[model samples]
Target: MVDYSILQKKYLVGTYVNRGLTFIAGEGVHLKDATGAAYLDLMSNYGVAIFGHGHPAVVERLTDQVRTLTTLHGSFANDRRAEAARRLTVRCGGGLARVFFSNSGSEANEAALKFAVLATGRRRFVACRRGYHGKTLGALSATDGRKFREAFEPLIWDVVFVPYGDIGALEAAVDDATAGFIVEPILGEGGIIVPETGYLKLASEICRARGALLLVDEVQTGAGRTGPFLASESEGIAYDILTLGKGLAGGIPFGATLVSRDVGERIPRSSHTSTFGGNPLAAAGVLAALDLLDEPMADHVRKVGAYFMAGLEAIGSGEIAAVRGRGLMIGVEVRSRRDDILKKLQDEKILAIPAAENVVRFLPPYVIRESHIDDALAKLAGILSGLSAGSPPPCAAS
Candidate 1:
């Protein structure tokens, strides 16, 4: 047998902390490693596999499209692309009239920022502290994280950062020159921090009163991850722009920026275009995702998510500082040894990811059942109990 990890370390850029496991197959919410070990996936590849891996609908649609026509420039209209865009816009209806397709979430936020500048004719923007937009230059400017931004100094245009969930700070940050304010409905990468109730609605009002556009970054919280098509929808706010990615295309590389009619009109022709922006393959995946991510599936996510959160809270371990999130996007804020806990979970045939400094974030697939949650909670309880009893973690030294 070949050791893929050694080859990857030698050839690929060392950007990611490899978990030393190679997944060869995935079905439903379970992933099988090269050695045929089954592992329950709670991270969902950072919230991408909403329908779980190799969902029948997504596989069937993608299979048909791949055989037909895969790649086509955005300048040409394709049947699948047109249908996908129409359905997506209608589903996100809050005066949203258009969508600009891209390859990733970072590109979606980048386009939204540029469109905001064009629509409002201002280069300044506002963002929230602990908010994660993306790593691209334009998006990074609005992402308030010193770790990601410190290396790339003097990023894009003028961007002001303010405390999240604080209406006063957000309102004070926006002024005459502020074109827009970008924020995540839930801070996924920043540790699954959910904002206060009506925070988005109040921010929308502030942006409108100040002649600035509101851009809701739903990249992590969208596509049924948070028990809603868009997390901002629950807030009853009509934002000027909304960004979506991750599982919007059922594991394909896809991003979309939905804009209001007014904001859409401000974007001129040829201002932005992508070669594989609206590829037929990705469009088919989007259609499949839209069909499966119905109201019933969303309700399932809510019910199962609440049950999972309650289970975690019931553990009542001293190592856990808090358990917070909405829908399936949960975070277990550990007082310390977050990485050690993640490693232990891996050892127990489960996979999870870390966020911020001390959060064991769980972006489980919507298809995750109560039994899966129970299994994960059981393992977590054992790990936390061991930690609380002064037992050294399995991978503490590493």
Candidate 2:
């Protein structure tokens, strides 16, 4: 039998941290590995599999498009592409009048930054500390954190960093020369931090008062991840720009940056174009995602997410420091040895990912039920107890 892992390590770039399991298939909420063992997927591949893996509707939509026409440049109008863009604009309807499609979250941020620069004719931006936009140069400039930006010193543009959730700091940061303020509705990579109530509304107001575009990066919280198409919708402020990706297209590589009519009009013709940005195949996935992302499904996410958090809080383990997040994008902050805890959970066949330094992040698919939550809680409780008892974590540190 071929050791695909070894082959991949030998040939592929060694950038990503491997978890030592090669999944062969996924169904519903479980990923089956090469050994035919199934593991409960709580991370949802960083929140991309909202309806879980290989959902029939998603597969059918993608399969149908694949068979018909897969690739058509943006110069030509494709049915799925047109429909996806139309629906996206309508769904993100607070002055978001148009859409620019891309192939990933990073590309979405890239387009948002460029459009902001074009619309306002300013090269300066304001971003929150600990926020992550993407690794691409344009996006990286707005992303805070020395680790992501230090190696690439002197980013694409000048960006000011302010404290996350601090309205006063934001007021001091935005000026007339600022093109836009790029921020996540909730900080995802920064340990699932939820801002104080009405924070986004106040931030939007500050941006507007200073003539800066409010660029909301909903790449992690959009597509109903936080119980709505866009998490910032709850603030009721008319956002000038918004970005979406990661499960926006039913597990397909897709992204969208929605802009207000004013901003869209300012963008020059043929300024930015991606070959596979809105191809029929990815568009089909977007339509399928929109179809499945309805009001009831959103309500389910809110309710079940509360239940999951409640379970975590009830565990009352000494190892747990806090549990925080909105909807399914949750995190359990541990006091110490975060990697050992993650490896222990992996040994128990329950999968989760890490964020920040000590946060165990869980971005489970929307298909998760109370049963799944209970199972995860049970395993986590056992793991925490074993650690508290000074038992060796089952494997080497991740």
Candidate 3:
């Protein structure tokens, strides 16, 4: 048998920290490797496979759209695209009257940032430390990690970094020259850190008082990942701009920037455009995803997330520093050996991912049940117990 990993290393760009596992197929909340070994999915492809893999509804809709029209330029209005924009705007109603579609979360955020500058006529912006917007040049300007931005110094715009969840820091940062303040409802890649309640609301109020727009990056926390269509919705925030991606189009690549009428009117024609932004194929996937990601699925995520978090806390291992998250976006902060714990989980046929520095993050599909959580908790308990007993991970000795 050919070594797929070797081939991938030779052919693909070495950007990602590949985990040395190749998945060939996936069902509801589980993935199968080339060897037919089934592993329960917890990271959900970095929170994209919201309805799990190949959901019947998503498959059916995407297949039908594939058989019909797939791509059409924005110059010509397509039925699917129009319906998609309508449904999305109505669903995201916070005076969000328009949408600018793109192919990834980065592009969505880029559009939001550009619109903010256009609307407010200010290039200065405020973002939270450890907040991840995206990696594109414009979005990277607002993203706060030195690792991702140091080499690309002198980014597109001037952005001030403030502490996450700290309203005082945010209020002090925004002024007359600030275009907007971009933040995540829950800092997903920054270790699944959920801000204090009323944080977003207060931030919005501050931005409003300062005449700066509020942009919420919901790429990872939206589409039912955090028990609501958008996490900011729960906070009752009426942001001036909002960005969404990840699972908004099922497994298809998609992104959207929803804007309030005031902000939307300021974005002139041809200011931003993508050839394949609102293609019918992705729009069909969006409709199907919306249908499946209803209140029942969100309720399931909330219940399962609470249960999983409780189980992690009940492990009673000193190695676990804390467990934090909302809905299914959970993070288990460990005292040490975070990578080793992840490898151990992989050895046990469970898949997870890392966040921040020492967090074992879990973005399990909404379909995950208490039983699935139990399976992961069981493996985690064993690993923590072994570590507490001073026994090295089994794979480490090999």
Candidate 4:
């Protein structure tokens, strides 16, 4: 048989950091390799498989939808798609009345930006520096950072950048010409920086007063990843535009852009549409996901998340500069050699991901419990201890 990794490197674009590890299957929160070895999954496929891999409800729902109907164009109405949209809009609340489905988080943001432009009749926008929306041209325009934007110079939209978690900068950047201000609730890719309380409220008020739409990108913080169904919910601010993706469809590639009735009415027909958006299979998964991610699971997330974070904070290692995040979305800023520490975790079969430049981000499955936290914490402590003693991870020869 051909080596999957080799074939990928040979035939596919080399844009991702190939971990040189492949999994054949997943059950619950663990992924099994070809050799039948299981690795603890902490990152949940970059926060996509929030309910965990192959959950019975998600699988069963997708299977049923596949047998019945899978794809249908948006021009026609379908049962599953309609139910999914109705439930999503109700759950998202905050005066959002309509949903535009898409295939990924980038597509969701792309729709949000376009709707903002059409509703407000403005071209300029405000985005947080070091924030990540997506790589598509329109989404890329809102995503700040030279790393993601340097090659795609002279981005299509006019956007000004401001520091994340800074209300003063946000206020100064947004003006009458600003159509929208898009931001992540917890600043996920910006090192999981949890802005102080009242930041969202103040930003919402400023946007409304200035007549600029407040676009909340919950692509990472939504679906109970950060305690509530949306990190924006707790702030009690009615966002003009909201985007949801990364596991909203029970592992199906799905995205939804919700807008207030006022904004939705302004969005003229044929302005934006997607072929694969709201396919029956993905819609079924969304329904199943919504059913499973109920109030009890939300409570569980709050309990387990606090437990995990407390354990991480208790690890008194000088190498760890800080630990910050909400619910299952967590990050540890290390003093140095963050990648080396991540390698050490991977060497021990504990999977995680990176955020910003110095943060070791952990977007663990909500199914994680105290036992899992204990295991990861033990491994983390041991690795930090080894680093302090001038010993690195097994393969950290670099």
User: Each model's RMSD to truth, in Å?
Assistant: 2.7, 3.1, 2.9, 2.8
Residue 263, model 3, lDDT: 92
Residue 291 error, candidate 3, Å: 0.6
Model 4, 1-398: lDDT tens digits are 66888988999999999898889899888988988898899999999989888999899999999999999999999999999999999999999999999999999999999999999999889998888999999999988778888998999989999998899899888889999999888898889998888888899999999999999999999989988899989799886999999998999999999999999999999999999999999999999999999899999998888888898889998788999988899999998899999999999999999998999999988888888889999999999988878856548958
lDDT of 2 by residue, 1-398 (tens): 88888888899999889888888899899999888899999999999999999999999999998999999999999899999999989988898899999999999999999999999999999999989999999999888888788988988889999999999999999999999999998999988999988998998899888889999999999989989878888899887889998998888899899999999999998998899999899999999999999999999999999999999999999899999988999999999999999999999999999998999999999999999999999999999998888845548446
Report lDDT (Cα) of residue 95, candidate 1: 85
Model 3: residues with Cα > 4 Å off, grouped in runs: 391-398
Give one digit per residue, the lDDT tens place, for model 1 in 1-398. 88988998999999899898888899899999887889999988999998899999899999999999999988889999999999999999888999999989999999999999889989999998888988989999999878899999989799999988899998889898899989998898888898888999999999999999999999999888889888888787776999999989989999999999999989999888888897999999999999999999999999999999999999999899999999999999999999999999999998999999999999999999999999999999999999888856658957
Model 2 regions more than 4 Å off: 391-398
lDDT of 4 at 243: 96
For residues 1-398, write the lDDT of model 3, one tens digit per residue: 88888999999999899899988899999999988889999989999998889889999999999999999999899999999999999999888999999999999999999999899999999998999989999999988877899998999888999999999888889999999999999998888888888999999999999899999999999998889888888678776999999988988999999999889889999989999999999999999988887888888888898999899999989899999998899999999999999999999999999999999999998888899899999999999999888956658967
Clashing residue pairs in candidate 1 are none
Taken over the whole model, the C-alpha lDDT of each candidate is 0.92, 0.92, 0.92, 0.92
Assess the local accuracy of residue 380 in candidate 1 as a C-alpha lDDT between 0 and 100.
Answer: 94
TM-score of each: 0.97, 0.97, 0.97, 0.97
Q: Return the number of clashes found in candidate 1.
A: 0
Could you tell me how far off, in angstroms, the CA of residue 186 lies in candidate 2 after the best superposition? 0.6
